[model samples]
Target: MNFILYSDVNDSSISASLGRPEYSYYFVLKAYHPVLESLGRVHVAASVADVDVLYRQLLAAGEDSVFLSFTPPQKTPVDLQCPTICVVAWEFDSIPDEEWDSDPRQDWTQMLARHGRVITLSSHTANAIRRAMGEAFPVLVLPTPLWESFAAIRQQQLPTPVNPGTTLAIKGCIFDSRTLGLSADALIPVPLTPEEEAVLAAELEAARPPALTLKRRFVIARHYLRLWLLDAGRQQIEPVPRVKFLSNWYWEGVRDLLPDAVHDWLERRLRAICAAQPLPVAEPVPLNLPDTSSVVETRVDGVIYVSVFNPRDGRKNWHQLITAFCWAFRETSDATLVLKLTQNDLALYYSELMTLLAQLTPFACRVVVMHGYLDDAQYARLYQAASFYVNASRCEGLCLPLMEFMCSGKPAIAPDHTAMQDYIDDSVAFVVKSSEEPAIWPQDSRLIYRTLRHRPDWGSLKSAYERSYRMATTQPLDYRRMSEAAIERMQHYCGFSEVQMRLSNFFEPLPKVTDVASATDNASC
Candidate 1:
């Protein structure tokens, strides 16, 4: 069976450097590798906005493909047709539902007409999907993200002397060799011998030298792993369960990049096991976060960073978001919040936002804003350099950039709600209750969309944020704790190995669902 994951590619963190935004798309794509290989070739489509046009292009090209779409389109275009399954990553898919509103997207009455078999990440979303589309519609829960490239990469990076495992070579790539902890002998020369090492060698040679030296650093560091494992073997006791968390550029970029849900479970599980004893501190394994050392993150005095998009008050909220900078001047005073309004930031949203900031807030005069459209390199650096990051929105799918702060070993303050609760633990960052503004933020729309999707009043996001912040900031915002909790949570929940068993079981019996051929009115029409 061919598998394809479709969603907005812009949702991913990798896209700024390589892939698009679709965070789940990347996670699922990465996770499905083994399963897809077991079944057949799996293809994923990032949230391509022009899906219909892209659909036609693919059809014209005659690519034998199957696709898995995430959410349904907002409007029912008569011409909208494609070979895809629309699955809504739901609340029970391991995310809290309280932060979302009951009528998240009730406005899109036309789109529900075209939906096929709607899949939820969990039963939470399944019920919501059914409620929204009527009893006639079908919803299946897909669950949390599957292990992606990181799992394989992990095997390479970790080699306990006792558990000096070997890679069963099936593919070759710089990342594979580095992450899998395989030696150069294993990367290429496709082991002609019956031994797995032979297969690994052939794969490495085929993978070629990485485009970047750092990419090959692990491959080069292979020699050290052998010695470390030797040292590990001499120790009597087994090492603590290695825990970790992964974060990246935009917080949303790496939300599920490391499979944090399962990681979180495993950490608590191991902690429970260790309740009678001491355990090793979980290690923070930050992947694909902003690499400030990279040449791209540099370009002069300041870089403009825009964290807000798709606000309920598109332009007006843009005005309030800019006001955040005014607070920054009094509170942070070191960094600037460049209001990035447009996708490309070409229209100078920062300048206009600054003009508005000047008119509002106590520290308006102290703040200065500029516009120059920050590229990935520049923005990544700014995100890195900032003393703290801020996300004062009403709603969120998962406030990812806060993860960026944690990943970079910096503290952040987010409105306590939505997916932000999933990863940003209280011990790792600052959390604040919801802002008392009249404006509806972008995530609020998603919140509204979610509320409409399921049990709307259930999740207490504002309270969760306040509590989480208290938890994270009880002590000084030490970089060590941030990194430690980040690593611990990431290791326990986000890592593929940590969650593979759960994911495999959940997806083992590929959801057996049929299309809803009919519907009834559940909304106030």
Candidate 2:
């Protein structure tokens, strides 16, 4: 049967979509397209908006086709006419009972159950879905595919040890200062003058919204009531008695019933609020580097530790990672910790990262912050120059960077929890201990977005860093063995042959069209 790959991310050019959903899906296309073509013609939608048209065309052609949506199940077009499959990556280990009523994606399981079959990236997600949906729900485990094309860019040579020491440059952006409650201004003030204090107080007062007028309160209540009613209908939840009558009217009709003056007033209030918010007037300075070195340079006998992630994403636990690394190597000048931040705006978090670094002063080890742009070749160099790939993430939804590094024969220092559990082990990585901790579900807005996930032990992570550093420095033979193991494990897990077999098996059970010629003729209509 033919396969129709559909994703909204595919709408943009690959280059513009890096560090986005498109980037991940691009790899999926590379891994699946060839194998799919061998079975039958594989067509991709122009965009997610075009999937409905494509689905209709496929049906008219009488072709045996399967629609695979590489986005969240809720985002899938409800009107599409095809046998659809949703590929999802959920990081949580379980769905709590309390979240069923508030989590935004709570309906995701039931929606997929009704609209299409499910494909998850790991068994953890599959189990969670099964528990929430049902034991008999059809959910397949399809690990994210690593593109073989990356093999061409893999480091051609192994890292050579330097005589005195080496600097490991971690390449990436820094988090915005505002994210860490630091001043976004170029200079953070220790104290404020009387005039400055008055200005600050006025600004703070302006930031607060004016007291709600009785008319405004009515308008806001009506707006939310209409939304709640609509949501209840869409998710099939029982409408509360208070809004039961509002649910009977079309949403547009209910909205029309509101006075035009209310909208105008609301708009004015929003604009006023926006105007009160402070804007940054100056660019932030670079943090934590020696005057002698303009860039991170590689040195011999020096172990370079590297990790790449978005500093703003709470799941990454970057603050803890930096703290642990500093504590572990405080007295060692032979090693450096490199953080490659993936966020686009470096100024957003540079000051905060520096602030965190400042708390670890009087240490011998150097911490480098890589910011701004780098071409693909430049990025590959960062990976190739590293002694080991480290991840202290609290959870993961199939870490692509970790996988890519392993594919290039680099040993890893990572936590064996969440998605990493699928492959991480002591044989291939310095596995840090972790335990469940309460957290806010990143996507949820209700109940203060409360949730739970693994929290990697900082002490254990510090020990891992020390162990990996010692191994890279003194135990060359063991390090080589671990590197080889990392390559072998990643090869088996993400190798093309293995992925092809899995894909083939996934489709074998589905019925196929018996007459391709007849189907083509019908499709022309």
TM-score of each: 0.43, 0.70
Residue 406 local lDDT, model 1: 44
Summed over model 1, clashes come to: 71
Q: How far is candidate 1 from the true structure (C-alpha RMSD, Å)?
A: 29.6
Model 1, 274-303: lDDT tens digits are 222346799855333222222221121221
Q: Taking the tens digit of each residue's C-alpha lDDT, what string does model 2 give over 401-488?
A: 8888787777889998888888899999999999998776554446454456898999999999999888888888888888888878
The segments of candidate 2 whose C-alpha lies over 4 angstroms from its true place after superposition are: 11-35, 95-106, 153-155, 159-301, 448-451, 512-525
Give residue 261's lDDT in candidate 2 (0 to 100). 80
Go through the candidates in order and give the clash count of each. Answer: 71, 16
- TM-score for model 2? 0.70
Winner by lDDT:
2
Best by TM-score: 2
Q: Score residue 42 of candidate 2 by CA lDDT.
A: 88
lDDT of each: 0.39, 0.67
Report the lDDT of model 1 for residue 416: 43
